[model samples]
Target: MAHTSPAAAPGAFVAASDVAALAAGAAVFGTGGGGAVHTSQVVAEQALQEHGPVPLVTVDDLGPDDLVMLMSGIGAPTVGIEMLSSRHQIDLLVREAQIAAGRPITTLMAAEIGGSNGVGPVGWAARLGLKLLDADGMGRAFPSAAMVSMNVAELPCDFAILSDVVGNVSVIKTIDLHWLERHARALTVASGSICLGAHYPMTAETARGAVVEGTVSAAIRVGHALLSAADPVQAVAAELNGAILLTGKITDLDRRTEDGFARGSVTIAGTGADRGRLQRLELQNENLVVLEDGEVLVSVPDNVTIIDAETGQAISTEMLRYGQRVAVLAWACDPIWRTPRGLELAGPAAFGYDLDYVPFKEINR
Candidate 1:
C-alpha cells in the first residue's frame, strides 16, 4: 500500500494508521539495522494509545533558544529481541536528561531514522508532551552513536542520560564526544547489552547548523517507495540513487558476542549477473562494509544493507546465516561525511580499517 501522510500535523492527531505507516517506512530506512520494525511499531502503538499522539514540530518552528533533547536505544539488536524495555526506562532517561540539562526539554528529536531509534523518540515525546522534530541526525541507520554526522561536525555531546530496563539510570557529562560514546557503550554493556539514552540537547539554532535536514521525510519516502514498487530493492535504489553492490547466497558466517557488541562477517557466493564472484560483509551491530573479490565495494558512513533476494525484507546483521540468498545495497551517505574532517571522525579508518575512505559512487563506478 502506498503511504499517506496523516491529516493532522505530526503530533496533533496521529491515527494508528500513521504509526503503522511510519513504522513500515522506518524499516525500509533501517538499512539492515535498528532492530525489528514489528517490535518498534507495537511499542509505538501502545505508547500513542496510552499517552496520546506525539506533537510534531519543525526545526524552524522551535525557538532559537528552546532546548531540544535527542533520544534512542543503543545495544545489540539481538539482545533487543529478548530484553524489552519498560516505560520506566524511557521516563528515567528523560528525567535524568532534564536534570542534567538544568532546563525543561522543549522538544525531542530522533538520533536516527530507523525501526527502534525512530519510534523511540516519539514514545518519549508523547509521554513528555514535548514536540518531536520532523528530522533526525542520520538519514539512515548506523551502528554507533558516534557515527552520526552531528558528531562529525563537532556538535556537543556533553550532557546525556542513560537508563536500563532494570531501573538503573545515570546522567553522564563527558569532556569529549568520543568519551561520551565510550562511556555510554560501557554502561549499555553492563546493563545487559542494551539501554535507552537521551543526549545532545542543542538549541534550535545549533540544530539547524549541525543536524541533517529532511531525513524524516527521506525515510518516509524510502518506505513508501519500497512498499509501492513492483521491485522493492529497485525502488530503494532508485529513490536513494544507490548501487546494487552484490547478489549472492550466504556461504559462510562468523559471529560472536563480545564486549556487548554483536560483531561478525559473512561470505557470499555470487549468482546471476555476479556469478562466481565472492562478496564479504563485515558488521558490528550494523552492516559496515561490502567487499567484492577482496576489494572494498562499500564502507562505513555510507549505508550497507542486506535484504532477502526474493522478499526484499531487510536481514539484520545478527540474523545472517549460511545458505540464505541475499542482495547487498549501498546508499550514499550525507555529504558532510565525505569531508576530510568527517572521514577522520567516522570513516573506515576510525572503524579500524586501514583503507582510506571511499564513496560508494567512486567504488561502484
Candidate 2:
C-alpha cells in the first residue's frame, strides 16, 4: 500500500501534532534498527513542546540554490539509554556542518525515517532555526550509512560534522560514501559508542531528485493508524503493505555487544496460529534476517520488525528478552533498495547472509 494519502496531508511539512505519532510509527518501520525511541521521544517531545511546531519544507519549497543535509543519531541502542545527547550538542553539530558549507544550510533531513533518528531531526531543525525537510534518505532503517537512497543517486556525503555529548567533535571530508561510513563508524565507537551527526549536504535541486519524499508524513500516518486501531501491529503491517509473519514468544535470545553493535539472534517459540514452530532472527544493531524451521524467510532490504504482541509496540534489538510475547512482521523495502546498487549496499549478502535476496513481491508471486 502507499505509505500515505496526499489529500489527508499535513501541509508541506510534518506538523508538531505529528511528532509523537511519528516516533511510535517509526519504531515499527525501524524494524529493530536505528536507536530506541523512548529516550529520543522524550527529547523530541520536549523540543516540540517548547518550539511549538518546527517548519516542514517540501522539496518544491526549496530554491535550486538552497542547501540541505542529513542529520541522524548513530550508535548502539543499548548504550544510548544510559547516555542521552544534550539538545545543545545536536544543535552544535548542525551549526558546524552549516558553517563548513560556507553558506546557509536550508533544511535538515533524516538519514532514515525509522526509530529515534527519524524524529530527531524535527527538533534539531526548530532549535537551529532551519526548515526540516519532509524528505529522507532511507525509507526505513539500515545498519550502514552508505545504504541511503542519496548514495544510490550518486550524491556524495560532501562533508560531515559529528559530535558527542562529552565535547568531542570531528569533521570529515571523504572521497567515497563507503569510506565515509567506515570512518564515521570508527568515530562513533570512539565517541562512547553513540553520537549525532550530519552529512550528505546537497542542493535543494539534488534533494528533489535524490531523497525519498513525504516519508516523515508517511511515518506519522502509519503511527496514527496503529494508535487508533484495536490491533495496532496488524493495522500497521497491512497499512504499510507488510504481513504478520509469526506470533510467538521469544524463547531464546543469544546476543552480544560487539564492535559498538548489538549483534546476535533471537529464537521464538511459535504460538497461536503458528503453534509448535520456531522462528529465528539475525541481528546487527537491527533485525537483518528471518528464518522459520531453519529456512530463510526474510532478509535485509525486506524489513523484519518484532513488535510486542499485546501492545503493538516495536521492540528494539536491545530490548528483546527470553520470554517476551511478540509478533514478527515483514514489509517490502523501498523500490530503491531492490536495485542492483541498492542490494549491494544492504542486501542479504551485504550483511553476510550468504544468500541472494528475494523481493517480497516476488515471494508473494
Best by lDDT: 2
- For model 2, residues 226-252, the per-residue Cα lDDT tens digits are 888998877888888888888999989
Query: Which 10 successive residues of model 2 have the least lDDT summed?
Result: 1-10
Best by TM-score: 2
- Write candidate 1's Cα lDDT for 25-116 as tens digits: 66656766787777777877877888776666666677856898888888888888899998677777777887888889888888878667
* Model 2 lDDT, full chain set: 0.82
**Cα-based lDDT for every prediction:** 0.76, 0.82
For residue 348, model 1's alpha carbon misses the true position, in angstroms, by 0.5
Question: How many clashes does each candidate structure show, in the order listed?
Answer: 3, 0
| Global CA lDDT computed for model 1 | 0.76
Error of 1 at 241 (Å): 1.1
